[model samples]
Target: MTALRRLVATALLITAMAMGGTAVAWAHAVRVSADPAPDATLATAPTRITATFNERLQGDFAAMTVVGPDGNLWSDGTPQVQGATVSVGVRPLGPAGSYTVNYRVTSADGHVVSGSWAFTMTVAGSGSPGPSATASTPSADRALPVWPFIVGAVAVIALGVIWSRLRRT
Candidate 1:
């Protein structure tokens, strides 16, 4: 019975240590900071956007969309990830106005975090955000079949082989 008690104590210590290690790993992710500082007022257009997190965010696949005062999308591409930070390029503004930066990301652990922030630019006009990329839209060609490309490639190769054989004969 004494030997069994010792074993149980050792197992509990090991379990606690394992949970502690996982907590440390997950500690890498909370949002530590952001540029445009959440609700900053700027005299001019910001050349870039940045978000800093406590944990290392999943790098390449994070998505970001900035809706300009005109309601147009200002993000040029998928946000780029570097270390714990993710950033994206911005579009030039024709007018100064309020803009909202809507951020969404999935952490390395697969948890999705989403939020929005607004900033004012004194430079003076507003435009509709260019397009709604965050929302899904219906497409006209949803019923298209995938086999046509495969069949066409085979047909073309067959035709080429026949022509070569005929020439040889």
Candidate 2:
């Protein structure tokens, strides 16, 4: 009985360690906050858009764009990353309509994180529309290999079968 209990405890410990490692390996950077915020209604137009992430970002890999309601690009200049925050300048907004902000940034861990949000302007501006631009979609992260987990589970089952046979004998 003591031997059986020890075997079970050891199996549980190994399973826990494997699961913890897998969780860490799958972790990705997340968006913490944004300047105009998601679905916010602003009284006036914002000259810039800023997004904050939970992890440090690669400056060269960071990109953001502001799309006006008329299907025009309003984001001006390249995005700048300072630590975990990324900001991009925007041309004066035109008309009172929803503006979409799209962003993609490479996390410090090399994972790409991308998302889009929109804010509505209550008052219109005198700014003219610019060229059309496409927003980048979030690239899917690489999935962890499944063979190891399957093998580990099979081994655990085999161990249990062996233990059961020993007990019967």
Using lDDT as the measure, the top candidate is 2
Residue 138 lDDT, candidate 1, scale 0-100: 21
lDDT of 1: 0.71
Model 1: per-residue lDDT, tens digit, 1-169? 9999999999999999998879645543577788878779888777688888877677644766777765567766678888778887776644677777776666767666666677888885333335754452222233347699899999999999999999999
How many clashes (backbone atoms < 3 Å, residues ≥3 apart in a chain or on different chains) does model 2 have? 0
Give the residue spans of candidate 1 off by over 4 A: 1-28, 125-129, 132-169
> RMSD per prediction, one decimal?
16.2, 6.3
lDDT of 2: 0.84
Taken over the whole model, the C-alpha lDDT of each candidate is 0.71, 0.84
